[model samples]
Target: MQPRKDNAGFSIIELMISLAVLVIIAGMATANWQGTIERHQARQTKQELRTLFQVARHTAINRRQMTTFCPLDAANACTNDWDQPISVFIDPGSLKVLAQPDYLIRTFKAMPNGTLIASHSGPQERRYFQFNPDGTVHGTIGNLTWCPDSLMAERGVHVIVNFGGRIRWGKDRSGDGVVEKASGQPISCA
Candidate 1:
């Protein structure tokens, strides 16, 4: 009788099964990672908008004056230029941020390829808004536009500041965070 020999290695079927399982696990991990990244971006974007709104409110209260956060065409008054960046400061009875020097109130870099469209009524608006000493947002002004550079592996974030000085973020066209709507409108102190 002839002796039979078997290879001391896994069969083709075993190799295929192992590869398939690894691929499945990898896919799941990728999906989870993507979700986490999106949520984080959304939160960050929300925070930035809130910070600006809060700062304006605090300025109005602390200085006992009205404040405005909006965009401009040139830098002047409290700002060195307009539409360049967001600004924050006191202007007579109005604390306005709308020029260079002043517009640099803060800075935030968007995630790669991620787009940020901010508007009081639309998503494609720019960074513009206002606040009163009584903690109310002015006009249909406050809007923020942002976009990521790409390669961030997530969805873009959006923020809006309505006439009530309420900053909100959102995934769709609706606002995010919280906007008091009726109760948030800016008001005079006297």
Candidate 2:
């Protein structure tokens, strides 16, 4: 009687081939996931800024008083850095920097790591966002650039506040369906 050689289960070559295919698939999935995450984060940050501006504008109009938005320092005064906690408060009947807990209306936490906030205005102007009684921004009209970690892809957004205090987001430039800064190009990375 000839010895029986059972031909069952996968051979070594077949198992190796399947393992290679799985690795390839996983790598592709991971690459795509990163881009998707970057886009979502950039847009989310942009929306948050737009909402904050709206709050500032509405507060000024509803209270029939001036409202200010700026980065909060240890002393609760306005600072040039945007990475710090942002403060929205009543103007407190004075043009100087915001005082302590008394006038603060709301405080926004610091931004995520690798994210940067830049203003069109210089240090002096970026220190404060003044909303007038008519819901318009006081002084110069400028925009804030919400730049993400990497500029290699369309992973950044812009919050453009027109001179009338109308805040709008810059999204999907040229209808590419990708959220990015619409400065005619991707902004430079830090």
Candidate 3:
């Protein structure tokens, strides 16, 4: 212990241990960062949905015409699948997709992958939620739930509209500071 040797630098084992510790820390930080990213994406998607619905609702009120909200096909016809691109158009009192080109108001592209847009009438009949000229929802009052492909802890968001055409978000039933389905339950991927 008294003799001075050639102590130039750290030993190979010491260097490897230091590097291994750093890698572990990096891995943990990366995982956390990914979770944060997912949470942000979920929030943004929810906000987009809110804005779209509000626009559709307000359009009908201002124009004093039936406003139809539904997914549109390549031919611009209304499609039942909500996963496709959606658009708001003048209902023309027919409740069908308008034949006139100017009837088309706005179109939203398909949502990002790993996310889902679904609608249900009383939890069974899937239908489009239309707005009346008076701003009240046309006979279709239900929940439009948006969920990620993988239902992680972040869960999902629901834009709930009542018969009066009032739009509100699902409550934080889980009490996790994250809004979930309006049914007081966590959203399911299926």
Best by lDDT: 3
Q: Write the per-residue lDDT of candidate 2 for residues 1-190, one digit (tens) a residue.
A: 9999999899999999999999999999997987787778876777678778988899888888788988877766777788777788989564636755576778887665445566656545377788888998887776666656665435666676777889877666566544455365545445
lDDT scores in order: 0.52, 0.73, 0.74
Runs of candidate 1 with Cα error greater than 4 angstroms are 1-6, 65-113, 120-126, 141-162, 167-190
Judged by lDDT against the true structure, how good is candidate 1?
0.52
- Model 2 root mean square deviation, Cα atoms: 3.2
Model 3, 1-190: lDDT tens digits are 6987889999999999999999999999998886776677778877778878888889999999889877877766666677787788888675566678798888877666445556655555354668888888887577776666556635566777888888788777667766676667766566
Spell out the clash pairs found in candidate 3.
none
Query: Taking the candidates one at a time, how many backbone clashes does each contain?
Result: 36, 0, 0
Q: C-alpha displacement of 104 in model 3, angstroms?
A: 1.2
Which residue window of length 10 is worst by lDDT in model 1? 181-190
**Model 2 segments beyond 4 Å from truth?**
7-16, 93-96, 123-125, 150-153, 172-186
The TM-scores, one per candidate, come to 0.57, 0.78, 0.81
Q: lDDT by residue for model 1 over 92-180, one digit each (tens)? A: 43444333355344433332334443433354443445566676765555445444433232344445556666666533322433222
